[model samples]
Target chain A: MRVELDEPKCVAAGQCVMASPEVFDQREEDGVAILLEERPGDELLDGVREAVAVCPAAALRLVEE
Target chain B: MVVGASAAGLAATETLRREGYGGALTLIGEEPHAPYDRPPLSKQILSGEWSTDRLPLRRSTDLDGLDLDLRLGVAATGLELADRTVVLADGTRVPYDGLIVATGVRPRRLPGDGAHVLRTVDDALALRDRLAPGRRLVVVGAGFLGAEAAAVARGLGCAVTLLEPAPVPLAHAVGEQVGRVLSQAHLDHGVELRTGVTVTAVTEGGVRLADGELVEGDAVLVAVGSLPNTEWLVDCGLAVGDGLICDEYGEAAWGSPRPKAGGVYAAGDVARWYNALFGVPMRIEHRTNAAEQGMAVARNLLRPEARKPFTPVPYFWSDQYDMRVQAYGYLRGHDEVAVVDGDLSGRRFVAAYRTGDRLTGVLAVGMPPKAIRPWRQAIAARAAWHETVPTATPAAGARLDGR
Candidate 1:
């Protein structure tokens, strides 16, 4: 699975990090999401998908390969 | 069976399906429409930025795939715990093997006409239609909902008067210091903020204050707090205070070990469960908690023997104009509040709420999630205040990024 995040649109609700902390991190200067892993295995797919879904601002997107 | 087909109810249903529960699933909701998210009702939907079609929590195709027995436009009037049956408003009794109550709260209406409350999509659309450009809007409460509505109204070119009875608006929720900062934000945005006064009556022309002062307005938005929908469970023998009392696992707590045969659980704004992280019981009304707790309750229902405690560090966010205020953990009963980063006057800073030496909560306005993420972790870990602080520089290179 591939994760794509639009940092500019992020309101930094922290729902992404709460869901998939291993794959996602927020910038210290701003709360925009920072992708730690662009491509994660099947184990992290569920959390990454949830992070994309729970985003209030719709900042995160997951592209299935 | 799940009562109330909003976020919590939908989440529980989805989780049950995901967890391989093949049993008969029924979702009962009072609203005629399908499950939808409520956060955008006051902001995007009211401001005319987003369409009503975007409000549904799940698409029609996804909901159809779930194969749920959806009973819309019907309300659950009573609960028969002994019989494992739910009494509907239309005098229909629906039996259930396991019950999950997600009946959310309703907006507390003011005792008069000419006032509107935004809780559901219908309420939002009605309020949006009335909020034309150059209309005088008087918001009766200064809570998050009221503040968001006032902001939306102001954005739509309405003259807004945000009236609050407390000395500082949102002081009870976000602490006095942060609340004052937010109150100032509203004033800076040209909102006529009136504090230390109570509304006596809602007149035809406008609202009359306790001191006999009348604030004239074309429209009135009552944003007072909400009350949980727990009247249906009064005879169920479940402990109901502000909401249904439950354990961390979301099981209906009757003070002692269960003598009952059937299972009854609750989530979202309707469930008040003991939070082990905060050492207190709380019924969180936020959207995130509703989703998370609903999933947790579903898992616990499936596996009663291996029940995991649902102890989430409560998080909530509010958008007012260009400012985004986000907070995590319990801020109540905190003695000290320190601005760990940024200047409060600049309207871009992060503050740490502490009870003695332990970190209780973190509030950030315009501060990035990366900066606030560590504080939430510290709160969840129950770390000491000093432990959260990094080096001797204190505020310079003390970012809790790694260690």
Candidate 2:
């Protein structure tokens, strides 16, 4: 599993981190999404997909192989 | 119970009542008065022709018949999602079966003592007092709000100067054709229109430009932009972004490791979600978008099982210097544009925007009745570009009915 993010479209909503905490987090100042650990195990794949679906700006994307 | 009795909140409450929700409604707001018209703040309110007293969303008699427990001058401090209650500034917590978060945005403040922003009624009145005759008014940013302010200040006999960092004013939003009209308006009105300029220094009397040019003004109004008021919701642990995260149906799309709580929803400028037509999740802050979305959220909250998707064509308008500018649909990805009626040089015309072969948006200046409904229908039908051109007539304005 791999994760990609678009910083320009990010509004610091922090939804990506809330959906998959193991893979995403937020910066202190604005709460913009920060990738914590990418290429996560299969157990966290569903959560990653949820992160992509909920991002208001479509700022987060998940690449699963 | 509903806190923040703003446009979205009021619309939600009205919609809920219309849909036969009999639950007791408690509406609270920080303002002493009810929610009122905001757009007028830059126009009539700043011109001193309108007063803040006339801006409430509801009348005492109208609200009296609703059987509502309305609290004014109280602010929502925190949300205890577990308890399903919102904590107010006065240590009062109102619990509700469902919650609607519609605390709208405030103007993004700058780090200065004299600079002002135009978002609320108070802001408009303060700016009005500063716009005395012979005063020099410098406006930063050439967006709709800033442009409108420049026009009003000039109308009040003040010397106005507009500064836009972009190559052309409003080119990013409405394309360069409309932006040229803005530049032309300033030129015609004796306004010193400064494009591709930035304000690097500020003082009590004037602002210094990035190029070392001094724009002397008695008052400077910063109409840069706005940010959502979603600080309290960060702790609620829902999917948060530039706004409170909501799904297509305005439902909170929670993340993993965070517990998903039902009945949590967001609306107005603070709510961001995916627009089916735009193909991207965006945060729209226009008045119409908020009002329509508020109604959609209310209906969905009541009957989630059979709720329809929210897809009203995004539209917004501005009143500036005798021009009633109205735009329909989003123009984010538009690549082709054609002027259907009037001349661009006349500072009065309508321009249609298209992405590939699909008609995506239409913008009109000094012309409202011609563009609104057809643009609305085109957006609803996902009409193609070839299907939206104006019918050719003689030099005297063609009939655009078919288009």
Candidate 3:
């Protein structure tokens, strides 16, 4: 799964990091979400899916391959 | 089936689709519009920075992609748990294999028809059109929604008078110490802040306070909390109180020790589910929790064998003027608060809440998102207050606004 973080929409609420630490992290300067691992392993899929779903800003998108 | 198509209800439907549920699905909502994000209604939408068209939760094509038997503008009247049927206002009884109730909440209004409450898009627009540079705005209840609306009105050039029954606004929710910062924010922004005052009646022109004082204004905005939308479930029989009582798995709770029927679940502002992380029952009205809980309930419904307790590190944020107030974990019932970073006088500050040794919650004001991220981790890990906060942390309190 390829994870993409829409930097503009990220409110820096840091929900993505909480849901999937391995796939996403927030920037220290402004709190925009950064894709820690653009393509995560299958083991981390569940958390990544949650991060995308729960991001209050609707900033995260998952591209399934 | 999912009822009340707001944040939680919409999220549940999306998750069910994403999780490969291809069976006949239904989405019901009382509002005529599709699901939309509400956090921005008091801020951007009210301020005219964003238009109404930008509010939909998803594009129409995306909603259509879900292949839902979408029912909009239809209100749920009652739930027949025994028959697994939901009676609607349109005289239709829709049956579902498994049910998810996300009716959310409605704003509690003052005992009059003259005032406006900001729960829906229409409510925001009506208030927005009335607010002018010289017009007076009398706001009842100094809660987050009230404060945010006051800020917006003040920015729009309206003279705002904020009223609260408590001595300090938000003292109960953010603690008396941290509440000062918010109270000060209103005063600093040229708002007429009145505390320890009550509104006994709403007038066509203004409001009558409990202490025989009449506060006149061009408009009155009532922001005094909300009541869960549980009137429809009066006979559903799945334990209802401040919200729909649910087990740790988000399933509606009934009977003693455990839920008798697991087919029904609740989420969002309407669900008072047990939080395993905090070991207590809580119904959070925040935006993020609503969406997260919806997805959790959906997963638990689809995969009951792997159903895990919905244990979330609750998060909520309110944008007031230039400062953004953010918090993580359960801030309620905290014993002590420490200013881990920033000072009380300044706009930027981070305060940590401790209930005994454990760090129960954390609040940040005007701080960057990165500054508050670690605190969420600390609260989620249930880290001890002393371990994370240095011994020199100052107590969260006020040195200004002598009241």
Candidate 4:
């Protein structure tokens, strides 16, 4: 799975980090999402997809390979 | 099958597809339009910053590709658990292999037609049309929706007055100290903040207060919270108190035997489930919880054997003018609040809620989101109040005197 994050559109709701802590983290200064793992294995796909879906700002997107 | 095609229903449908549930799936919604994001209805939509076209929760193409039976403008009148059928308003019964109830809540409306309640897109559009320049907009309740509506009306060049019976505007939800700060923030933004007052009646052109005082306004907005949409499930035999009671795994905890293998589940604001983390049962009305709970219920429906409890750390955020208020965790029985960072006087700080020693909840006003993240973790871990070191100088703690 490939993850794409648009940091400029993030409202720092923290849904992404809550859904997928291993794949996403928030910047210390502004709380914007920071990508930790761009390509995660199958085990983490569900979490990553949830993070993308639950993002209030629609900042995160996933492209399945 | 999923009912109430809004945030929770749409999320559940999407999750079922993602989880490889290729069997027959159906989504039922009373509204004619597809599921749409509701948070912006009071903020951007009312302020005219965002168009109505941008309100949909999912793109049209994505929804079209879901390959599920979409039943719009059809209301579920009753549920027959004996036959696993949902009776519609038109007397047609739809059968399902498994059922997921995500029917959200409806806005509590006032008695008369003088006030408007916003719960749907139509309500927002009607309220938006009345927010003309130089008009008076009196909001009945000072909750999140009321405050946001007042802020939006003020931005639209309307005179906004927020009425609340409590000492402070969000006192019941965020405690008095933080509520006072937020009340001041609204006052700073030129909102006519009225506290310790009650509205007796809504007149044609204004509202009558308890003290025989008449506050004349062009429009009145009734923002007094919401009630769960559980009236249709009266015969479903589910434990419907304030909401549909469910187990931690979102299964209906009803009947004498509490059927474990049945395909009935509940989620979102309409479903009150036991929260293991807080050791209490709660029905969260926030959008984040709705989406998360919907997904959790969908997973449990697909894999009943390995069902996992939906114990999410409840989080909610509200935007009023330039101030953004965010909170996480359960703050119902908190006894004390400590300002760990920033100054309350500046209207930018992070406050932690504690019940004796365990940190129960956290609230941040105008603070960055990153600062609130660790507090969420701390609350989930049940960290001690003293363990959270104050990062700001001159730490100020406020004791919640009553409640």
Candidate 5:
């Protein structure tokens, strides 16, 4: 599974960083999300999904093939 | 799913898309323009440093590339949870797999005509246009918004009079000692600060205080407060006191999450959720809480597995008269106060709150690091009063010089 982000909508509220720091990180300047990886293994899937759910700007998306 | 394209809605949408759900995504916003930073409206936008074009949460070009059907300039008039559809003001019905209410809050309007309230970009612009040299502006309320408005108006070369009913401006929120300091900031800047004055009635060019003193002005901008935009859900059957009732995860007390109707979520200024620290339901209208809770709702929506509670240390800031006033944690229960650094008389200081040995919260004027460091300690060690001593090594932004 891959995570796709809508950068425009993201406000970098730090919810994703708090939930799963490995998958989601926040830019220092304006607090917008900086997605580390597009896709992750099953171990990180749950976290990536949680990150998506908590993003206030609705900026995260999960890509599946 | 249909979610309002706001701080909370945008966060929820992104979370849904990131969780490997490729279902059809529909985002709608009432404003024709995209979402933008709001806190700056009272500062940068009013000061002419930032323009409306630069205010959107995301640039229009970026929102368009998301491939989701983005609707702007359309208001969501009604919601049929049972039908799993929302009726737009344009007479269009959009079906949603899930619904997230992120309508946010609007400014409270004044009583009579010609009185203005600030909420949206348009509102700020209208006020800015009227704020010219030699014009008189009477702000009714000495809260953060009122203080910022007065400061901005003064900066714009307008005469401003700030009237607050409270003897101390922010005593309810920041304690009496700190509030006196805050009020003095306005007095130092030539703001005609009047405390304990209630505006009984507003006339054409002024407001009449309870003492029969008529305070005159060219225009009246009422910064009383804000009411959440939750009228649409009147029939939705939820416990909405000040705002829509929700759990910590941002799920509505009664609603369906799926398109069919199970788990509905609310965020931003609209959701009054259960708070862990206070042990009672609380509502946070700050920009930080909105974004954080929006994410929490999104995570809980997609996967129930490994869902974490949204227990955030509250933080808020205000920029007034070239000062960056920041605060962290709750100041509600603080009984004892200490001045860790700076002095109120100088109009630059940091006030720390404590309940016994526990540090409850911190407030600072332009001292970001000193204000923020205690929050980390408070959250990490849950530091109480006596335990929270001034460290030898201050954080990056701490002002080291002392009295």
Candidate 6:
């Protein structure tokens, strides 16, 4: 599974970090989301999906490859 | 069964399916249109920058793949807890082993019609049609919703006049120090801001102020406030005041010194749940809260034995022109506000809110999310204001506004 982070759309609410801290982290200067693993394993899929849903800016997307 | 097919309701259903709950599920909503994100309604949606089709909470295929018994265009009029039945507006009484009330809130309106209150897409579209170049927009209630609409209208070349009963636009929400900073964004952008004014009604000419004066405008947007959609919940046994009262676990409860409703829960703007994090019963009306709380309820409802308390540090954001306003934790009822970082005059700063010693909230204007992200953890950790807040301590020469 591949996760995409649209940096410009990100408002840096840190919801992604809260939902799945291991999979997603934010840039310190601006708070834009950064994907730790662009392609997360099955075990991390749940958290990744939750992060995508809870994002206030609707900045994250997941693709099943 | 989920009673409101919006964010909270949709999130609850999604979590249930994601957790491998293959049982029968029903999603009910009053609006005929499928679930869509609301935050954009006042932003690009109202400005005609984004179409309605672009605002779905999730793609249609993903939503339909859930195999929900989709009941749209009908409202859940009555919820009979005793019979374990939910009576619908279309005369269907659906039973449920577990139920979630995510009916959410409706925008509080002024007296009379023609004026707009934006809670739904239709409301935004209706007001959007009236707003054009050189049009005059009289906005009542300088809250986030009102301010956002005003910004959008102004961007579209509408002459915007924002009215707020409070001296500062968001003084009641964010303290006066921060409110002044953000409210200035409107003024600098050519918005006529009238503070400390009570709006009586929507008149034929425009908005009628309490002082027998009419603010003439081509269009009026009443972004005053919202009330929980808890009328149908009346006489249904669960305590309903400003919102449906819930325990820390998001279960519907009776009253003060309350008893829990075992299988019935409430989430989103419609719920006033005990936030053990802040030791307060908070009913957050933000989009993020609705989604997060909905997931929390679904998790607890599935495994009541392994339930976790819904102690979320609430977050909210509003985009008005170039200024991006974001906040973490609760701001209402805060006793102290300290500008820990940046200057309000620059329109780029962060303000920390505290009640007693505990840090209750943080407000950041035009700062990067990363700058405010650490504060979220502080607020969530129940950090002390003096120690945890950046540059807000005595050693840092903090100027704490007791107001």
How far residue B187's Cα lies from its native spot in candidate 2, in Å, is 1.7
For candidate 2, the docking band is: incorrect
Model 5 over residues B152-188: C-alpha lDDT tens digits?
A: 9989889899999988898878888778878887888
TM-score of chain B of 4: 0.95
Residue B255 of candidate 4: its Cα lDDT?
53
Per residue, candidate 4 scores C-alpha lDDT tens digits across B1-403 of 9998998999899999988999888999999999987888888888878788877877787788789799999999898887888999889899988999988999887666768888888889999999988999999999999999998998889999899988788777778888888888789889999999988888888888889898889999999889999999875677788888898898877855443347888888899999988778999998888888899999999998889999888988888888888888887777877777787888788887877777888888888776777889998887877777443423554444424
Evaluate model 4: give its TM-score.
0.93
Q: What is the per-residue lDDT of model 1 for residues B1-403, given as tens digits with 9 covering 90 to 100? A: 9999998898889889978999899999999999988988988899999898877777687788778999999999998877889999999999999989999999887667878889999999999988988999999999999999999999999999999999889777767767888989889989999999899888887899999999999989988899999999885778889999999788878734444755889999999999888888899988888888888899899899888999988888889999888889988777667778886777788878777788889888888666777788889999998777533422433232110
Give interface RMSD, per candidate: 2.9, 16.9, 1.6, 2.1, 6.1, 2.2
Tens digits of per-residue lDDT for model 1, A1-65: 67888775566677888889899887776566789999988899889877865665556666656
Which 10 consecutive positions of candidate 2 chain B have the poorest summed lDDT? B394-403
Off by over 4 Å in 5: A1-65, B255-261, B355-358, B368-371, B389-403
> What are the candidates' individual DockQ scores?
0.44, 0.01, 0.66, 0.51, 0.13, 0.60
Off by over 4 Å in 3: A1-8, A21-23, A35-48, A62-65, B255-261, B395-403
What TM-score does chain A of model 3 get? Answer: 0.92
Which tens-of-lDDT digit does each residue in B1-403 have in candidate 3?
A: 9998999999999999989999999999999999998988998899998898777777788789899999999999998877789999999999999999999999998886789999999999999999988999999999999999999999999999999999988877778878988789889999999998989889778999888788999999999999999999875677889999999999997744332455889999999999988888999999999998999999999999999899999988888888888889898887777787888778688888877788888889878776787788888898987798777666454222211
- State the DockQ, from 0 to 1, for candidate 4: 0.51
Per residue, candidate 2 scores C-alpha lDDT tens digits across B1-403 of 6666777777777777767898888877877767676767887789877666656555566567567788889888888777888888899878888888888787775556689889878788889999978999999888999999999999999999998898888887877766777678877987889888888766678887878787888999988889888776767667777888788887767755567457776778888877777566767887666766777888888897887667656767777887767777877667866777666667567777777777878777765352345565686688877767743521234222211
By how many angstroms RMSD does model 5 differ from the true structure? Answer: 6.3
Better of 1 and 3 by lDDT: 3
Fraction of true contacts retained by every candidate, in order, equals 0.52, 0.00, 0.85, 0.48, 0.11, 0.63
Model 1 CAPRI rating: acceptable
